[model samples]
Structures are given as structure tokens and as C-alpha cells.
Target: MSRIAILGEYDPTFEPHIATDRAIAHSSAQLGCEVEAEWISTPDCDRSKLATYAGIWVAPGSPYRAMEKLLDVIRYARENQIPCLGTCGGFQHMILEYARNVLGFQEAQSQENDPYASHLFISKLDCSLAGREMQLTFTKGSQIATIYGSLTAVERYYCNFGVNPDYVPQLKSQSLQITGSDSEGEVRVIELPGHPFFIGTLFVPQARSTVELPHPIVTAFLKTVL
Candidate 1:
């Protein structure tokens, strides 16, 4: 059986965390494959164990116990071509890892972690998106659009922070692309163009997944590793 490492502290009461586990099961069933998904606390994450997993899911619920460790894991996955899926807080860290390592913004930070940082690539959204479902349009021909088989989708958001608009232009590169946006054009999703599978979403797609129909995003992610 293939294994998947869920990177984050797991909370039984957190809806996203629970949904994340269930989403993986639903996808594996849909794909007719057996998968072992393990939740590894951020502070306990080690690259040696991480390399053994077929893929990694950077789970939500942040202000993680070990932020630097979380970022390092992301960097390892990005450089190694490991299929990676990040959502909500996971999405924020993905941008942070890229900014600090790839874009040379070593001081870049998430405003949630530091409101007065020198550079905040991730800032609190003007209006909270918790308990809300919103529509997002995917970039034509992008990986997300192709996976969902559509140009638009409505996903649930349990987050209050997102990628800062001021830094959006800097995030666009040959490899990393902003592939999905809300009606107002606020960035909602990003994907690595050439990697086997590397995607992040400000909204929690796992929350919308169901037993009868697992989310295409999660299914697509599992497909890469399986």
C-alpha cells in the first residue's frame, strides 16, 4: 500500500482536519487503491520519514508548533518532486516557503504569525471567509481547471488570511503560477506548472468532499502518487 504523510498537528475536533482524513479515504476508494495516511505533528516532522511517503498533504490549523520545520519540509518536497497538496494554512506556508527560498525574501512572513513583520507575503483577508462558500474561476488550461473539468468551482473556506495582493505579482514565475481566483480576483489557488503534483488552495477543498463523490483535487493528488 502507498503511504501519505499529512503535515500538521492533528485535532480531532477541527473540521478541516477530520475532513482531510476522510477525503483521503474517499479518494483512495474512488481510485481503487489502498493508501495509508498518517498525521505527523509539525514539530515531530523529519525529512527521513517524509521521504518514504508517496506524497505529502500539508494539513490546515496553523500557528504550527514548529513553523521553521514546516517550511523546511515544504522546501524538501518542492525540490524533490514529491506530490504535495496544501490547503488554508498549508497554502500560506507554501507561499512563505517559496518566497523565502525561491524568491529571496528570507524575511517574508505570514501576518497571522507576525503582524509587524518586515515583509508579509501572507496577510489577513479584509473580510473573514470562515463558514462561507465562494466561487472561484480557474485559469484556462491550468492544472486545476483540467482536474476539475471546469473553469469554475465553489469551495468552502475556513480561513481568515490569504496571499497578500501586493506580493501576488512577485509570486508569478515560470514554475509557480496563480491558477485560481475569486469573483473579485482575489487569489485562491496556486500550482507548480512542471512538478508531478504541487498545488495549494486558500479554501479547504477537503471540507466539500463527500463519500459518494470525493473532490477532484484530492483525487487528482492521490492519482499522482498512486
Candidate 2:
């Protein structure tokens, strides 16, 4: 059985947190596979325990207790080629990890974590996306487009921040590609092409998942684990 370690501080009252667990079960049942998913609080996470999981999912609800610890695990996944999926706040921190570790932006940070930081790769959106359903377009030949089986999708969001527009151009390197965005060209999804499965979305795909119909993105992430 493949085990997935979800890195986030789980809250019972949080809809995204609850949906995340269900999404995993939905996908595992659909795949006819027995996969165990566990939530590891940010402060409790370390690379040793994380190394045992077949895949890593950095869940929503950011500004977690131990931000640096969370980023270290994300770095572990990226550097060691462990299949990883990030959504919402996870998306923001994933890019922050990439910026500081891969892009050589040692001072890069997320505004939510450090509002006064000098280099904020992730900043507050001009307008909040909370509880709003919006349309996003995927790069024609990107993995996201292939997984969704469409060039565009209407996804739901519960976030108030995203990749800073000022740093958008700097984020698209040879490995990290900006593959999905809103109609206005705001970055929403990013992918690491050669990794088994390394993708992050600004929208909460888990929120849209149901037992009868699992979200394709979550399903695809688990498929890579298998």
C-alpha cells in the first residue's frame, strides 16, 4: 500500500481539511488501491518521517505553526523527486520554497507569513478569491491540461493570496513552469515537468471533490504514486 503524508495543521472545522481526507479516499477507491493518508501537523513534520511516504501533499490553511519546517519538507520532496501535490496555501508555500531554494532568492517569502519581507514571491491578491468559483486556462500541452482533459476549467478558491504579479516572469524557469492561469493571466497552477508529480494549484480542488465524482487533479496525483 502506498502511504501519503499530508503536511498541514488539520482542523476539524475547516472544510478544506475535511475534504482533503475524503478526496484521498475517493481517489483510492476509484483506483481500486489501498492508500493510507495521514495528516502531519507542520510543527511535527521532519524529513525522516516524510521519507517513508510514497507521496507528499502539502494541504491548505497556511501560516502554519512551523513555516521553516514545512518548507524544509517541501525542499526534500522537490530535491529527492518525491511525488508532491500542493493546493491553496500549499500552492503559495510551494512557490516560496522554489523561490528561496531553486531560484536563489534566499530572502524570498510569502506576504502572509512576513508582510514586511523584502522579497515576497507570494503576496496578497488585489481582490480575494475566497468562496468564489472562477475559470482558469491551462497551458495547451501541460500536465494540468492533460489531467483535466480540457484546456480550461472552472475551479473553486478559498484563498486571499497568490503568486505576486511582480515576480511572475521570474518564476518560469527551465524546470518550474507556469502552466495554469486565470482569464486575466494571474498565475493559478504551476508544474515541474520531469518530476513524477509535482504540481500546485491556487484553487482548492479537494473542495470540489465528491464520492460520486472525485476531482481529476487529486486522482491524477494519486495515480502517480501508484
Most lDDT-accurate candidate:
1
The worst-scoring run of ten residues by lDDT in candidate 2 lies at 166-175
Give the lDDT of residue 166 in candidate 1. 97
Model 1, 1-226: lDDT tens per residue? Answer: 9999999989999999999999998999999999999999999888887767999999999889999999999999999999999999999999999999999999999999999999999999999999999999999999999999999999999999999999988998546999999999999999998899999999999999999999999999999998
TM-score between model 1 and native:
0.98
| TM-score per candidate, chains pooled | 0.98, 0.98
- In model 1, pairs of residues that clash are none
Runs in model 2 deviating more than 4 A are none
Residues 24-78, candidate 2: write the lDDT tens digits: 9999889999999999999998998976699999999988999999999999999
